[model samples]
Target: MAHKKPGGAQWWIVAAFIGPAMLAILIVNVYPILYNFYMSLTNRNGPRRFPEGMYEVVGFDNYIRLLTQSEFYAVFGKTVLYAVICVFFFFVVGLSLALVLNHPAIKGKYFWRTLLILPWAVPTWITAMIWRFLFHGQFGPINQILRSLGLPAPNWLSDSFWAFVAITIVNIWMTFPFFMLILLGGLQAIPTDIYEAAEMDGASFWQGLFAITLPLLRPVALPAIILSLITTFQMFNTVWLMTRGGPRTLPGQPGATELLLIWAYNQGFAGQGQRFALVSAFAIVVFFFLLGLTLLYNRVTNVTKGAYE
Candidate 1:
């Protein structure tokens, strides 16, 4: 017997149920991306804005300029470096906390977990602002405490290196809890019997961690790491609030802490002259970069799985 597909009326019923959501997504998400792509091909610098038919098509000039510009490359490279560092620390700190919290001997696990997650729970903008104030060069509490101990307090935001470090510290504090929660869940999902069998076999902690726990956790942790990488790559508010991408290493270049998103914001809105089309090109490049990264990661993951199987 042959099976029939849904008839027009049945398909119409299904569409009736999902059409509104699809329309909403198209309007909210899909349209803006398409518009941005269109804008990237135009010369729509601010004060000479694009009207329906007035904007001049610049072809790939905007993209070519971004690619050839050393400053743009610097910002892109720094953004990648920032994401890598943040994700690495997120995994390390989160996994360590998860292991400690998962320890059978630890009491009041619930209380400690709640306390630890407070930073993640609080509004990120508020946390960023608070950290900014705390890192103030002379009058902040951190400097005050250092002075009480008779130690020199370096200006946190006034120096390029320290400003980068300061933002990284704040981002790590705000983000590590997410990794901790994910890793904790992965740890809990691991069977205690596996550990018991290893213990019975006289396997050392380091040996068991390397041979068993990490291998098993890999499947769970990989996705979380990718997510954290994406989040860190686009991080803007916290770093912007902390330094406004200041303490520049060069006169006209982006500050050490000005990652890709912040650089885009500066070019489009906050710079001496608004370059809307240039920013749009930058956004397109970023989109492709992330897309490539995600695809490459997934492909590698699949290849690894296949090999293991």
Candidate 2:
């Protein structure tokens, strides 16, 4: 039989099916990013100024200000710390849960799996609100339990360190389930024979985990880790809802828990003066930073995997 190439009609059909989605993406995603980049170069301060066309192109002033400002550096550092802590805990907890569930002797695996994923199933806003109440200063259950136990109850939201801890706890609770699901899938994909071989060779659990499981799991886990890192880096809703990024220790600085997205939001909308241009510059910087990190991560993971192979 002769091979026939797709004709113009087929190409048109393909484009017809893809055109709406492509157009939507361009308008909804691509256009806004480009517009924000353009706005970052201008001195537009507020919504009113945006429409007036009176905003002057300030060039690199906004970028320079963001890069030079102590406040920006503080927030950026805190955001990176938040991402690292959250992603680290997420991996540890998620992998532990997956390992437990993956054990051959475990019963009701489906039921346990379902229950474990409930946190991710809930809306993040609702989870944030619940955690907020739990972390309430006096009447909250956590404090009540602490007082009952004859222990001092620290004010969670009003104190800087506790507020940071509270936000981190809430974020970990809400996000660990996602990592659990991803890691569970990875665990199940591993061949039972590899593990059995390690066991037959008298490998201990920890030895097998390090020698057999981890190396095999890396390929599956790395992408999920990167995704979790990005998600945690841009986290805003849970932090905002829980503390409003508060327990501010410094007079003119962001709250201890104010990650990059929340800082940008405060700059753009929450503060006394709207700093649209500054916010845009911050967004541009964050976009490029994340882009570079992602590229570097992928490159490193590929190199490591190739070396292992």
Candidate 3:
């Protein structure tokens, strides 16, 4: 295919249409990122004893500290763990649900769909707060229920491992509706004739699913899955709300629930003068990690090349 050059008039029209969008993208999305990048090289945090420290131009000093610190490494590891778990389960659970919800004979489908989507409709911060109360160590509904049933009720927010598990479950619950809706749309778009043909071939449901349905749905859902993964990778508010990063003693780390976002939050806001630049450095690292993941996903899935005919 030959690239056609846009003539002068067309270029003007293109700019006319694109001008507002580009402006919005820059102001709303791109500027903050660049600002953070610039801030990453400064020392923006300290005690009142060092007011001069705020404006100090410490080139890559923050980045050096973030890279060399064991606490930072632990946080990064936790972030990766959280992202991996949430993305994996979110994909599986969301796709499975979307498949089931799209079934032809499912009764009260609209009602069920609406109910399923309700969780997503609620503000995530509010949901997180609610779940936090439900998972409270003393009077939480979870423990109460478990106790009533004569079962062990693990501390959902206290223990480090369980806190991660709880975070994953919350994330999965919060995000499944999006996947359901996307997959539902994809499933509806699939050609019925293909399934009919599989039936004619006496193909089992599983065979048809693997051979036809998955390949067909990939194109529609792949972008959504990628997007969800990206968002979940940078997840912050839910876990923060749930535990306030939790009881400090359990993990024996510098902070509780040592995910990158939370760690950055602690660094930026915790004790004295906010370490905005250090936080920015950590944020920059996370941004690259997510960007790398997106690039890898695109390469593996050929998402940009148009996967479906």
Candidate 4:
């Protein structure tokens, strides 16, 4: 007969199995957040290598500076606009392709799927670099083609409007595949019988889509959209690599394409004087903003409930 172990012994055994992972998480994730919060409350500046006493607590000064500065609002606005545009296009392109691929007449579905997903499969940094070359006004194939067609070849990276457009296009290209995959899976999981019934009722394609497909797709789509929004909001690699948040349109202001994370990164490392505490404060504010966006999404949509229902 197997003897039951003591409760304390079982607890210890469980802890032993999980202890190292927990410690690793604390060191990697928890420690950084705690340290960042600590830094936000101080006046830490200069390089990363510094003695503890070099900085002292400044309480809410950093946060006050971040909030009161008009530059913060401008950057925040641009970031929001970028995320909105990218996510909107992501859904539209993804849903359109998914619908087409789901059609009964479409052939070589796998090939099409692979082709569409290629952009997402490529490393993001590589995508950014490739697009940067593609947008070059003088030597880029895009401008060459435009010249051949007698069309204007605008300065893509140097003009603020065109720079924004270039980044938006790159972002859309890199991300739409993710939405397509998710939405395609969601569409496939839906029952054919539902559509057949709608057809029997003499519904047109658009009617069926609005009345049936879209409603059913919401449970999956909303969550994906919100997740995409959050990801796009924090996106740095593509924007930074391509534009470095440049094509500055205004004096004493943030760059046109300088999104939130890029701004935070620039504050810390991209300048002669590193403002570690200010950057930390900015990060904390961004963290809270994202947290609020998530909570608000859940509260408004009740996505978890809809998924089960």
Candidate 5:
């Protein structure tokens, strides 16, 4: 018999109610992650074709193949390039926006914040499509505006490098709002006394920012930056919808804009050779690579806790 305290009966009742939720986590979340781990060792397609069509364990062949393939390497490199570039731009733009908004003199804060974040609220696909039209060589508003201003408008979509830039522009627009909000939170949490104290010491505005405020803000903002990097590293949909990885990238290589996710999609759906095994291998490799990267970054940065302090 379960012993119940005088007023603790309700606690037990609540526990009984939550018992099923714990079970759901075990069944839904934990199980899928474990199942994926198991699947990573094999070369298998969708649900088994028959009872006997079990997964064939290919040892480390999937990983080996994924790491060794030139196409995979190229895609991997592009993924890193895209992630780094986008994060750099996002950090710079978002931090600048946060700094500006943190100023007491800035008016219409709520309105400006809502306007900035509207892009994030809009559906990604819609934003991507809109950007596609805006980058369209013949009739994009961008081109029209340039023409109206008496400036030459380059064909944005046709050029490989420019198309990649177009993809980054959309991603940056979608992401910067999130960064700004997080950084703004950090900025707001800062103690006003620190600035006042610095001013009393004859510190200049820039000195207060560099010597006092930045150090304090970094601790609060580091996690946001790390999360952004992880998400950017896995970015896909916008680039996929915008470029389709391109007109004719190479015989087998991914286009300039094709990151690892698109490369995996192409491989998984590659008509001539439907290599589900290979695709799984690539995904597994990417997963571990990102995992390793996060761990290493965390270790090196020593940003585990209270970095701002």
Candidate 6:
């Protein structure tokens, strides 16, 4: 059959097929980001403060103010630290589980793999809520165990340090299985001959792991690590449900467990006054930071180039 020209009826037919999806993407994804940026440039706090048309365009005032605030840097540093810790554990735990499961001597591989991945299979929100109960100061199972053992049952969700630890554990538990699955696939793709060669060459278990397994796993693990880092940095639901960014570490400051999103959330909704513009500015800053992170990761890793290459 002869090929049709790319115009007129053909273009309309193509548009007819894709127009709804494109429009939906614009409305659902693109519009919100653009609106948030717009909101960031204004002083729209709330109806009481701005009163619909009363809000004024403040140029870069919100960004300037946010940048100048010490709290912003504090929260940002805390967020980065949280992400780093979570990702580190995610990689370590996942890789360990994957390596064990990949071992030929391991028994019940399928069963153990399925059991280990249950956390990832469960809905994160449900897990967060369940963990919240588990971290309860009194009646929770964790504290109950501690009390029964005559150990100090520190308030997990109320103490500043423990609250941060609680949220970190929840996030790590909910996410590590993802890394396990990815790294496991990478592990399986490796040829047995490579390890056999290493063994013959007198490389020890730890040496083989560091020099061969880890290096080979990089292509698969690096992308997952970067993605998890970004996700953990912006994570809100798990942390919010577990601690709501409390308990306060200092007066008139962000809570100890307040990652970037949680702080922005409190600023916009949970605070005495809804600082919409400020939160929008916060969102914009976070968006750019994440974007820069992704770009930098891709630049260094060439992750987008190809997995095998």
| Model 5: per-residue Cα lDDT over 225-307, one tens digit each | 77777888888788888887764445765777777887778666645445666676666667777888788668645744644
Per-model TM-score on C-alpha atoms: 0.90, 0.90, 0.84, 0.91, 0.82, 0.92
The residue-level lDDT of candidate 6 at 142 comes to: 96
Tens-digit lDDT track of model 1 for 1-309:
235565456787889999999999999989988988988999887755744566788799889988899989888889889989989999999999999999999999999999999999989899988998999997889889999999988898998888888888898899889999988988988889999999999999999888987888887688788867887899999888887888886788788788989989988888565888889998898898889879867875765564223
Error of 1 at 234 (Å): 0.5
Model 5 alpha-carbon drift over 4 Å, by segment: 1-55, 270-273, 293-309
Tell me the tens digit of each residue's lDDT in model 6 across 1-51: 346775457787889999999999999989999999999999988657656
Instruction: List the lowest-lDDT window of 10 residues for candidate 1.
Output: 300-309
User: Against the unseen true structure, what C-alpha lDDT does each candidate score?
Assistant: 0.86, 0.86, 0.78, 0.88, 0.78, 0.88
Candidate 1 stretches greater than 4 Å from native: 1-9, 46-54, 296-309
Query: What's the true lDDT of residue 31 in model 1?
Result: 95
Position 173, candidate 2: lDDT: 90
lDDT of 6: 0.88
| Candidate number with the higher TM-score (1 or 6) | 6
Evaluated at residue 180, the lDDT of candidate 5 is 90
Most TM-score-accurate candidate: 6
Q: Backbone clash tally for model 3?
A: 0
Clashes of each: 0, 0, 0, 0, 1, 0
Model 2 stretches with alpha carbons more than 4 Å out:
1-10, 46-51, 296-309
Put down candidate 4 lDDT per residue, 1-309, tens digits, no spaces: 345664456777989989999999999989988999999999887775345778888798999998999888988998899889999999999999999999989999999999999999999999999999999999998999999999999989999899999999999999899999998988998999999998999999999989998988887788888888999999899889998888877765788788988888887878754889988888889889999989967865764564634
User: After best superposition, candidate 1 residue 230: deviation in angstroms?
Assistant: 0.9
Instruction: For candidate 1, give the lDDT of residue 9.
Output: 66
